[model samples]
Structures are given as structure tokens and as C-alpha cells.
Target chain A: MGIAYPIAKVKGESADRIYGVKGFPSAALVDASGRVIWSGHPSSVPRGEIEKALEGTAFLPRLEGKAYKKVDKLIVSREYGKAHAEVLKGLQKDSADETLQGAQVSIEALLEKMQGAANAAVEGQDFGVALDTYSQIEKLFKGHEAAKLAKADAKAVEKNPAAKDEIAAWKKMVKADETQFEGDFEKAGKLYAAIAKKYPETKSGERAQAFLSRHHM
Target chain B: MKLLGLALALGAVLSGPRAAKVEVGDLAPEIYGEWYLSDASSLEEVRGRVILLDFWRTW
Candidate 1:
């Protein structure tokens, strides 16, 4: 998952300060030579004003409820999309120059491959594999337009931290010992039913219902 | 205006019946073998009068 952000440059200063904007991911400042100076989470900063303080522009996209089956997946996807968008935007400015043709071609190819992977992940039903592929795509594309699409779809529902806690609890149950797992399936079934009842529009809720439909028989 | 009205009436008349009649717990048509944990052997050609269809996945 990508968490780093672009650093805003200050003239006449040796060090660049990194500040995170809420609803986006963390980032670090990179000098003209691509050297990192500082980094932190974007959520710590103010909600929507961080973009104005930057010498260069970078915006972190927020997480969405519908896409978040688990908290980690949502956070990781949003962060990666933010970082990729910043880098891709920067690459486009220099890509047209004759001297940078070779580097530009490689970057463009990587961006295409990553976009393909992300699309595949979006279509995939298996959450784990889809997330894994989407993460790789974010790394590959770095800053393509598709990254923006992904970012927009994932920007709402970061208001509550309760979902994160619920995710942690759910992860513990899924990773419990085999004996415990077997006994807990009955409990898990009820939990799934409740989730389906509460969030019927979400994929997680649909999956919970599917589990019941299959297992209860 | 009259021709447009007539066309709209014909369109509605042509395309309205679209609801499903059959649902779950209805008498299902007969299908083949059981798909579960146990494997079938060639030694005995087993057959049964009643068939139960169950859908499942191995998470």
C-alpha cells in the first residue's frame, strides 16, 4: 500500500517539510533529484485545505464504505491511489521532452500494465486477490487517470474509526484456531446475517448472504 | 400529436409482461449426481429415487 505524499518545496530552505492532508494518504517531499525529505499521514492535517499550502500540488483521496470490506484494504487502496496520482502528474510534464523520451516510454508502459491489473482487480470477486492485484497496479501506474477514478470511488466514509475496530475484531475471528473456527462458524453465520441486514448494498453484505445461502443448506 | 400518441400506446401494449412466476421450494426438475466431500467409486453403480441439490463453497 502507498502512504507517502509529495513534499511542497520552500525556496532558500535546505529541508522541505512534509504535511499530510486528511481524506488522502501520507507522503514525503522529493527534491528535484527525487530524494525524500519528510513524511506523515494526511489525516492528521486539516480536512480539505492542505492542497493550498503546497508549492507543488498533491491530494490524497479518501476511503469509501462500499469498497472497504476490511479497513486495511480501503486505507491501502486510497493511499496507493494518492501517491500514484501525484507521480503520474509530474511525469507528464517532462514526458514530451526529447531527452526524456526513453524514460517516458517506460513509465507509460508501466502505467498501462498497472491500469490493466487494476481493472482486473475491480472485476474480480475474490477480495484478497483483487486487493493484492490492485495494490500492484497502483505501484505500476504511479500517476495515471485511472488512479483518479479509483480515488473518487473511495473518498467517502472515512469519518468514523469504528469500522476500523470492527475490522480488527473480524480479522481475529477469521484467523482463530481451527477448533475455534469450526465452533465459531455458527456464530459467524449470525454475524454475516446481521451484516447483510445492515448493509445490503455492500459487497461484503452480499457475500455474507451468499455464505448463508450455501452453508445453511 | 395523434400519431405520437398512437405509437406510445402500441409500445406500451407490446412490452409489459416481464415478471418471473417460478420461485424457490417449487418442484425442481431431476438432475445428476451429488457433489460433496465424498467420492463415488466405480465398483458400485448406486442410484437413488430422491435427489437433493445443495450449493456450497469451501471459503
Candidate 2:
């Protein structure tokens, strides 16, 4: 009953002031700007509205402030490469702007986090996670410092003699993720089991191990 | 005396932040309290997300 992100809970009276709630089980669907896009019981929120809001909604906010006003549009749309190039150009002209600096810092940190996790996966013999993580970073940060580093990391993983076999076994991991997200538990479970059986001693395998233990699949 | 105290408590609750009315399409007011079950410490961390603030109580 979980999604890709963590659910946050807050116990406070602040909920009372949000439109002065009228009854028990009041729910409000807010967009990124905190506007009440929908309000009512959870059941009443339209499914299409949720899907529409979810489009291009990544975990990170677009870099804030108007310091790089032109690039702001690009980042919001997830045109990272164009934004990256624009930010670089902005940084050259005015190096002191926090908003301009944010673009570099945020993406670099994200890259570092992924690259570090990939390295750990490789060390733990989870070649599937290692390759997938590196591949994503290599693609995601195409015009950033992380792209080169992820490529180098991918090459390092490829050097391992067991890398090919282990990575091949875990190839369906993405499909498992998609199925799980789609709520196709039976299919996802089978995919996970297949991956786990193929790459028995890795982190990717442990996904199936954990899923089965939790769901009794 | 007990009834007086209850009246005063209700008055205080009604006079608090809940005094403002919230309508659809209006910007939501700040929400905060003891947070749990999340990696993000503040709403700012989840800025890009569509947040559903649920108000519930244990029956």
C-alpha cells in the first residue's frame, strides 16, 4: 500500500485552520503552490485531476527565485540540459546569485547521491541497481558534472567479471517497478521472483525477498 | 463552575487560527506540527509535490 515516496504525518491543530474543516475525515488536494485544487473526502477527489497534477512532478522543486529567470521555465518543464547550459551562462555573468548557484548545487548533489548509491550497490554485488542507477544519472544529468562521473562509474561496474551476468538477470527490474506502481502485484511479484532467482545474492534480489515477506506473495 | 470552564475552553478554540474561513481555490495557510513517517522535515522540502493534507482523528 506504498508508493515511491514517503508519506508524512503531522499531528497538529493547523489542519483545523485549512478552510476551517467542518467534519471528520476532511481531505484537501493541494497543488504545488498550496492552492486548494480539490477539497472534500479522499474518495471525492477526481482521479484525472490527480493524474494531471502528477505529470512532471518529480521529488525536487524547480530551482527557485528569478535570478535565472529564463532558465526557470526550462527547469520547471524538466528541460535539464537547456537549463544547465543557461545556468552555466548565467553563472559566468553574475557569480553571486543564490538562485543561479542553486541549479548547480542541486543537480550536482543529486548526481553525487545517485553515484554514491550506485557504488554501494556495485560493492554489495547488486549489479542491477548499480547499472540502473548509473544509467539514469548518465542520462539525467547529461549537461552536468554528474553525467561524466556516472559514465565512468558505469564503466567501472562493467569491468567486474560477474557484471554482465548479474546485470542481465536484473534487467526486468524496471518492469517490476512499473508493474508495482501500476498496482499489478501478481505480475510484479513474479518479476521480482524471477530477478531474485536469477541474481540470488544481490540487493535487487532482496527486493523480491522483502516484497514476499511483506505481502506473503 | 465546570460549565464555565468548558465555555472558556470552547471560546479559546474558536478564537484561535480556525477563525479564518477557507474556500476552494484559496491558497492554503501554513500547516505545521510534530511530523513523523517522512524523510522531509518541512513542507519546503516537498515543494514540487501535490500534498494532500488529511485531517483525521482516532475514533
Candidate 3:
């Protein structure tokens, strides 16, 4: 797929979790003002709808109440980072809104909850989950104590052989993809072959083997 | 102590309100992450441009 537009690889499906994207191949059109004018399956969205949104006319009705309700729902779901992003985006439009202000309070409460969950995951020896949760916190609330703790925990987890190998393989896979994307097939092939050789049982390694077999590299 | 903290955290999440699906007319959540090309950009940077956030995963 030759996509001319800029693309981003969201680290760890955080965007999916925040946007509540249950399935892949989803599309969202954001207006100049940072409002999501339309969202749905790519095939379902009308081509004209995107054009109209870009033109700043024929927009879906603004529903502040409904937006707040959605934020509240994220709070209930313990999607603190998503809720925080929602309120922060809302604040971008109107910093003085009382409802958004109130949502901020709830966001703080949720962060505390997140910290507790991460800590619990660590105590339970669920280093993977703990590492993921901590990374989320670090992304959402940079410079916070919880983020710091998460960083420290990640370092500790890396000391474990299993965790270390998993992380290394993941990083290598990402690097391989990036190299492939940059049109350096030779370099990508080397990385993929290394992965396939080192982590033969892993899914990524399997994918690398498949890629190599397909390209006969 | 960690177990107690986890319980308390779980309690807080359970006690909080549920979030509904965000749809059209909702403020777009800011996109933050490393860019595949060039320096990373945020929703704020492209505030006035038509942004088609095409989210994908490589798994």
C-alpha cells in the first residue's frame, strides 16, 4: 500500500485502547479545530463526508453533553488515559468549561487507580502487565511519580531473562519493520533472519521466517 | 502493601463512572507517539489542517 500521507505506528496499541477501536482498519476524520468530525470503518465513511469536514461545513451536530457522557464512560471503564485525553482535547476548545474541569478531577482520581493497578501487577509477578500499565502511565502523565516508578519497574523487569529476551525481540521486530518501510530490503532481511534464528518459537520469529520465505531473501 | 494498593486502585476504578463511545462532533483525542517519518507531530501542531489519523498495527 503506497500511502502518501504521514503515518504513525502507535506504541503498544495505546491509541486503540484510548479510541476504543475494537477492530482494525478504522478511520477517523479530525477537523482543523481538533474535533473528530466523523469516525467509522473506512469503507463505511462517505468520501464526501471527509471533504465536507475538511471544508468546515456540514459537520455533525456538536454534542457537549454527549461528549461529557462519553468521558464519564471512559472513567467508569478505568480507561484513565483515554479519559484524560478526552478531557484535555475538550479543554483545548474551551479551557473554562465547568464540566471539563470536573472531568479533570475524575482523571486525577483515575490516575491514582492506575498507579495502584501497576503496583499490584508488579507485586503479583505479572511483570508484563505491570510493564505495559506503567508505560501507559508514563505516556499519559509524563514526569509523574507513577511514571518514574513504572520506569524503575521496567528496568527491574529487564533484568529477568525472559522479560529481557521478549523486549529485545520486540524491539528487533519493530526495527526490522522500520527498515523494510524505509525501502532497505537487504537490511530488513538480515534483521528478520536474525530474529527467525534467535527466537524460532516466537510469533514474530515465525512472521520473520514467513517474510524471508516469501521474498526468498 | 502492594496487594493492598492494587485492591484500593481496583476499587477506585470500579467506583468510577463508565465512559461511552466517542463519536462525531466529539473533540478528537490528541495523537501522541513517534512518527514513522520526520519529527513527531501532535494534533495541536496540525490544528488547522484536515487530519486523517490512520492507525495501524504491525503484529
Candidate 4:
């Protein structure tokens, strides 16, 4: 097992210059022959999976037709952009019930496993496995509080017809995240300010206020 | 006794970092409970695979 820290680089810099920035604890597994078999977030991917990834024996689960259908429906619905809030509300309710079930299990069990496995793989400097683990963490997060917030945000947008333009502007702001894109934060700040001005009581306005404060030039 | 110490050490390692985003090197936090795959298999069954779990609001 091996441990590797995450690298945070600007547009131009050596890949090795990761200083001060915090990294999530992720692990990777390596085989006897020094090959990566598995890797994932330090908290969730089981140690056993890391071993498998390191051994080149990791079995990627096949998504079934039903899951595909559900995802397709979600995508289609999101594109139309109506009823999204209600949809998110329903999904949040369902997810809440499922999350309650997970409480019975030991979260530490999975976290330890993934960490051990990642530790093994990082020894090989196999970043592909590292990236895969990050993806897994992204997936695992859907069942979390942030997912609920996302759902609520969607529902809120659905409730107010007048907020459509504001929501679109907010979406653009998110898409232009500094790490992801070189977005004009100044424009986003203006949009957020406008949304706040229009709907003083709305969460969108509140979020916009925060955005303006955080990304102020 | 050594095994117990190792177990404790692992426990500390497991609970170490908390980050908002799931980065490559960060620990994956337990967002919720048992996640079931489309195959009707419990998430526990695929403990070793990197999973891309996405939550979408269906309209």
C-alpha cells in the first residue's frame, strides 16, 4: 500500500509543486510486481478494492439498463428545466431513506479499506488509479448532505418562475469555477447581485451574497 | 498488542482528512448509508471497485 497527496497546480507550474493546499486522504494499492490494481478516496473505497486494482483484478461494475434509464430521464428532465425542484425533492426524500439504512454499517470499515488500498497503489505513482478513485468519491457523495442541498436548490428554482434567469446566471457562475475555468468572476458577481436585488428573500439571493463576498475582486 | 496498535493506527488514518470536494488523494467520506447498485447487489459487495455514484433530481 502507498499514500499519495493530491496535486494542485495553476495553469503553468511543475506538477510537483503542491504546497500549502490541503489534499484529501486517498490511497492506492500495488501488486507484488509494482503495478497499480486499485485506488480510491482514502475514506470510502475498501482496502480489498485497492488490492484488486493493484493486481489488475479490479472489476468495474456494469451499469444496468434500469440505471441507464433513470440517468437518461434525469438528464432529459434537467434540460427542460421545469419540475426540476420537485424532482429533486422526491429524490432527496428517497435518498434520505436509503442513507438511513447505511447508518447501520460501520463507515470506518470502508474508509480504512480504501485508504489501505490507495496507499499501496500510490507507491507506483499511478495517477490514473488516483483519478478513478476521485471519480468514485464523487459518486459516493451523491448520498450526502450536499446532494440534499443540490436537490433543494433545484426545487427552489422550480418554485419560482421569475428566478429562471437568475438560476441560469448562477449556473454559469458555477461552470466558470476558478479551478475549472477562467470565468469572469466580476460578471458573475454582478449577476448574483442582480438576483439578490430582485428576490431579497430567496436562497438564490443569499447564495449570491456569499458568492459576491467570496469572489470579490 | 501489535495488531491492536496497527488497528488503532489504521483507524486514525481512516478518519484523518475532511474536504468539501472529493479529490484524488482525499478520503471518501461516508455521505449516507448502503448504496445499492442496479444489479440488486448491495454496495458492500462492490467494496473494492471505484464507484461513480451520482444523485440526480428526476423531473
Instruction: Provide the overall lDDT of each model, using Cα atoms, as 2-decimal numbers.
Output: 0.32, 0.60, 0.59, 0.34
For every prediction, compared with the true complex, DockQ reads 0.01, 0.19, 0.17, 0.03
Q: List where candidate 3 sits over 4 angstroms from the true fold.
A: A1-102, A105-136, A206-217, B1-59
- In the range A1-217, model 2's lDDT, one tens digit per residue, is 4443333343444445434666656677666544557778766867776666665243334665555567877765555656777887888898987777877676556556667788888887888778877877766667776778888978888887878767666666666755653335567678878887886776667765666554565
Better of 1 and 2 by DockQ: 2
Local error of candidate 2 at residue A129 (angstroms):
1.7
Q: Per-residue lDDT for A127-214 in model 1, tens only?
A: 3333434444444334556555544422321222433433333333233312122334445557667666765554555655665674
Candidate 3 per-residue lDDT, tens place, A28-120, comes to 777754566677776676678666655542111122576588776665444555666777888999999888887777557657766787788
Error (Å) of candidate 3 at residue A53 is: 20
Which 10-residue span in candidate 4 chain A carries the lowest summed lDDT?
A12-21
Residues B1-59 of candidate 2 have per-residue lDDT tens digits of 00000000011122353333445544454444444555565555555567776665543
Error of 4 at A66 (Å): 26
**Cα lDDT for residue A135, candidate 1:** 46
- Pick the winner on lDDT between candidates 1 and 3: 3
Candidate 2: misplaced stretches above 4 Å?
A1-67, B1-59
Top candidate by TM-score:
2
Fill in the DockQ of model 2: 0.19
Model 2 docking category? incorrect
